[model samples]
Target: MKSLTLLITLLCFLTFSVFAHPPEGVWKKKLVWKEDWVQIWKTVKKEAWETKWKKVQVPVWKEIQIPVWKEEKVPDWKIVKKPLIEEREVPAWKEDKVQVWKKITKPVWKLIDVPVWKEIQVPVWKDIQVPVWKEIQVPIWKEIQVPYWKEIQVPYWKEIKVPVWKEIQVPIWKDIQVPVWKEVEVPDWKKIWVPEWVKMGIPGEKYLGKDHEGWEYTSHDLWRKKLIWKPVWKKIWRKEKKQEWKTEKKQEWVTKKVEEWKTEKKQEWRTEKKQEWRTEKKQEWITKKVQEWKTEKKQEWKTEKKQEWKQEKKLEWKDEWIQVWKPIKKQIWIKEKREKWVEEKQQIWRIEKKKVWATDKKLIWKDEWKSYQAPIWKEVKVPAWKKVWKPIWEKVWVPNSHGWD
Candidate 1:
């Protein structure tokens, strides 16, 4: 009954009004006996018998201890009573991982002073210099001052230099004829270019042919008048040297052809051979070749025999006048020796004569180029204006490939 009383009193105290503040001088405790059970019923405005009906419609949720009594049969009643003790337990200790105050981080910014250049767009009134060139034509002549002939042939890339003037032109884009830097151009006609004679390739000096005609062609030497010559007698005359006049006709055995070559036995040539053996080797060789040649005796003497070859031949002609000729060595490479008799001064020829350079070649620009004021450009208020500054540029033509005005 004592335990039952403690349980009911605790339940009655818990059921009391929680909104009431404890009065002064009154004990306030969480656990109380059934002494406050009347207060709980009064606050609800219901008698103890009606308490059940009062709370019937109101939802009440609380821990209530209803003592359930049951008698148990024991083998030995009250043999020994166990000591009354409160049970104690160890609780698990856990640390909370949730962050209380997290620090927020952001990128740091720095104020930087940057340099800027502003480009202003404006027309520049520069005295632009331009050159106006006139055409200069160079003649492609065979010789220095002569027109090319039918037989003369010129090759490519033959060049000649002629004096030309420098022209300075003013763009005249602006109203004023202010002169800029002098710019010149060498017009195609005005420029002296490859000449026909120059393209003739060393004027028979440098040639692929081994020799020119029967005469020798020598390499050009500035120091000496005469140079060495290799006879392309081998190259140009390779066919002539190795030529065989072969007539591919139907060949037949002919006793007549062989018998025709057989000459009558002449005692005049073979019988007196012992005396003719005294002939000089050079004369013998010349005589042998001359005898082999098939021609009229008179024609052979006049054609094969020249004044230079006279020394090697015998004076066999029965002529009316006895003509004598000069030495043969002096007559080489000469058309004739009669020119030697002419005045020595008259024989000398001047190649380049009466050639002069001309003036007024290129255009000339006016003199405002020295100190000309350029167009004014201004920019304000725009942040981008401070970023760009460009210079003014002008162009003009140059003379020829190598020279300029």
Candidate 2:
């Protein structure tokens, strides 16, 4: 069993070491670089410029034959007229005799029957009654006493305690100590060189020694003096007083007087007058005038005039003329110039270049071979896993009353 376990452990260790790092002891070929001089052919382009001339058409102004206008006036005839005397027949007015009707008016007297009326005075009687009023007396009203409730406030005296403070002096005694200085003669201490062996043999409580060669210093001694202090304090006291106040409330019953009145109806005697009317028949005279008309014969004379017309011969002068339009010829002359665009040959010079591309190889640098280290890769073999049936025994904790342990 120990031998088998050792073989399995050794195999696992070898496998882990082989896969964790790259393999060594492998040879590889590398390229070496070198420099040399060489020649090559390359293409190049060239350009050449040339001058040429071209013909173009241009516009110019020139003198040419054109139609000209001239202004000229011709003679024109017009008709004229003069005044001449002539005779014509026209209507005129003349005095003539004619017979006409005339009307004349004359006054005439006539008689007719007319009615007239006269007015007279009349009297009428009627009965009337009148009413009379008199003065009267009225009674006055009196008041009585009534009972009601009213509220009023009652006051009382009260006593309360209040705090009051009074100032007073209190004596406090305290003992205080004050520092007092005094001069004394003392020996001053100073450091001196001592060997380690000598310092070790000396006691810790013993000092080195006093300087005896006039090197002593003067010092003072400390002393305390007794003192007493007294402080002042004040005390507070409480006191009470009595006070009186007046308060009102609505809780009282009182009586008051109110006035009330009533009205009574009674009959009284009065005087009044009444008026009465009656109708009566009686004769009365009234004056009235009436209008009447009658027919009568009358004569009136009037004169009338009429309009008359007659024909008479007379002489009148009139002026006449005729209007005629005649055609007249005129000529107008003007000076002008003309211009046109003509096709003419013109020489224009320009510069042109021809490009020729040629390939020429150039040798700028030589090729070089360099040597460098190259990495070499190798295939590694891994062990394949196979299924093996075996029993696995594991220790697991079974839960009990206590926690897992």
Candidate 3:
């Protein structure tokens, strides 16, 4: 029991110690690449040649008779008509009466009215009311005051005291009762049986030789067993009490003294007087004169004369000439030609062969470099400490005229 208890206590202590603290920093993985030269198998093309059947054009020349054309001139005649113009005096116009314009002197008179304008100077006067303004000086009496700062004694916070609470750990000792098991011997009893013999007789028994006359009697010995209890002792485990002392931690409250700073406010005042000036205006009236104009017209009579022309028709006798055409026999000579064609044969083209440069594709092996990503281990930076602001009280000297009004 003691060994078991000690084993349990040791396991609990190991578990608590393992979970108390944790590991710091972080684990990181990165990818890295390395350059190296290696052999690689690749497909490449090369030029080669082999024998093959190819079609070609062959050129041949042969000569045969071909047709040739010849030209000759021949004379021919034709008949055509001729035109002539003759002038002979014949009566084509006759004398007739036609009206014509004649000029004569005549008198005409007309009465017309004409307008004439004349300008004259005339005086015009009008009565009108208009507004007029005049500037005058006005005295404006005003009392003005300006603000100024005034200093005085005022109450302000100087220092302060505050109570602070803090936590502390305390150790205490305690007594505990623990049960103990021990091996000991105890007394006990058990019962068992044994076999024993006893004498026995039968009543009214005759001679045993006669079997059938009287009652046959026989004597037999009987055996029996009895049970009894016996005391015995054995070794076993027993429980016992024991007292032990243990150490433990407890929380307690404590008080402390701390000093802090405070702020206060106050007001100030000032006054002043000044003077200013302004101006005013008024209205006035006046009279004006202007000039005017007028127009007049009159009528008069006059005489005019104009000349015109008229057309007339008359007939007179005149002479004219005419053109006439007549048919006559005349010979015209022209040149002509004759053509003939004949059958012939000629050669134009033939077949031939040529040689040229060409390329072909094939497979080969080559070596090159390739890139890939590989895993690697590297050292990286991690944050261990950080900056933080803590609250604390501090005292400083402040001036009275630091704020605005």
Candidate 4:
């Protein structure tokens, strides 16, 4: 029986050695019973089944901002002067001399005797005497005595005294009492039911220390680029005006005054001085004495009467004119202005606003503030699931207890 136990023990030892963990061999010698060995075996098997999680490198990133600037170009301008021309009319001056003649007259006189007649009145005077009488009125005065007497009377008035009466009045009053009504307010009471609140527990007491405030590994994606700038220049062109001077020989008509001597058939006038006799009859007046008498109011007046006597006499008169020869000269002229419509060819410079087009290309780069996340290398821990062994009591069948059945 000892031999059988030894063999069975050797067999169990070899089986445990084959399945045991390499680090658990030192504890296997101290085990006594099969139950304890089985327990150790299960511990070794659970140690092999449980697995350890590994840590890997992951990328973490953050975002930031940056600022940049750029540049541009502009144009400059200026002004200049130019010349222009136009056509107009101008006047010229000249003078001319001429010859002229005029006519004149002269007078001659001669003395001769002439006979004439006139009518005159002669006055005659005579003395006359007359007597006249006049009458006038005269006044005479005499004295006499007379007497008269008058009498007058005056008036007067008298007044008497009188009396008058007036009336008076009086008033009386009495006291009175009045009653007034007032409103009164009354208070009313009522009963109502109200709900009361009781404190149950403090809010958020269970999760006081469970706040997420730690750093965690995250991934972000971003890109990188570069900004470059280049300078370029463009030429500006415009249409401008330039003045050029030119002269041309031209023929035109001018106005002038011309004097001309022309012979023409005309009548001439002359005067001759000769002796001529003229006869005329003249008259004279001779007055004779004539008397006229008028009687009025026994007085006599004598007057002389006037008479006209005419006498005729023939008288000789002569007028003479001297013969004279005179020379007369006249001048003639022509007044005219010569003109013609003419068209002239000229060159004109015109200033026009013109624009020239050109193309200019330059590389322009602007640095703008950019914000993004970039990836970085870091280590992070993650949770992994593994199978483990648990010790528990279970009922199973054994070979024998103390006696065989």
**Runs in model 1 lying further than 4 Å from the true structure:** 1-295, 298-348, 353-355, 368-405
TM-score for each prediction?
0.09, 0.11, 0.14, 0.13
Per-residue lDDT of 1-405 in model 1, one digit per residue for the tens? 435845775564555535455322333332211111111111122222211111123333433334444443222212222233434443433322332442323233334343333333443333433444434333332323332323322232322223334444322212323222333433232222232222211221332354322323343322323343322322121111122343322212322211112123321111111111222222221222111222222211111221221122223323334333322222123222221122111111123333332222333333222323444332222222122212222231211222231
- The residue-level lDDT of candidate 1 at 132 comes to 45
The global Cα lDDT (0 to 1) of model 1 is: 0.28
Instruction: List runs of model 4 lying over 4 Å from the truth.
Output: 1-341, 345-349, 361-363, 366-375, 378-387, 391-393, 396-405
As a TM-score, model 1 comes out at 0.09
Q: How far in Å is the alpha carbon of 58 misplaced in model 3? A: 99
What is the total number of backbone clashes in candidate 1? Answer: 18
Off by over 4 Å in 2: 1-124, 127-231, 235-244, 247-251, 257-259, 262-405
Candidate 3 global lDDT? 0.34
**Superior candidate under TM-score, 2 versus 3:** 3
Model 4 weakest lDDT span, ten residues long: 38-47
- Ranked by lDDT, the better of candidates 1 and 4 is 4
TM-score: the better of candidates 2 and 4: 4
Which of 1 and 4 is ahead in TM-score? 4
**Clashes within 3 Å, all models in order:** 18, 54, 21, 7
lDDT of 4: 0.33
Cα lDDT tens digits, model 4, 229-334, are: 2223434343223334344322233444333223333222223332222223332233333333443344344433344444433222433343433323334444
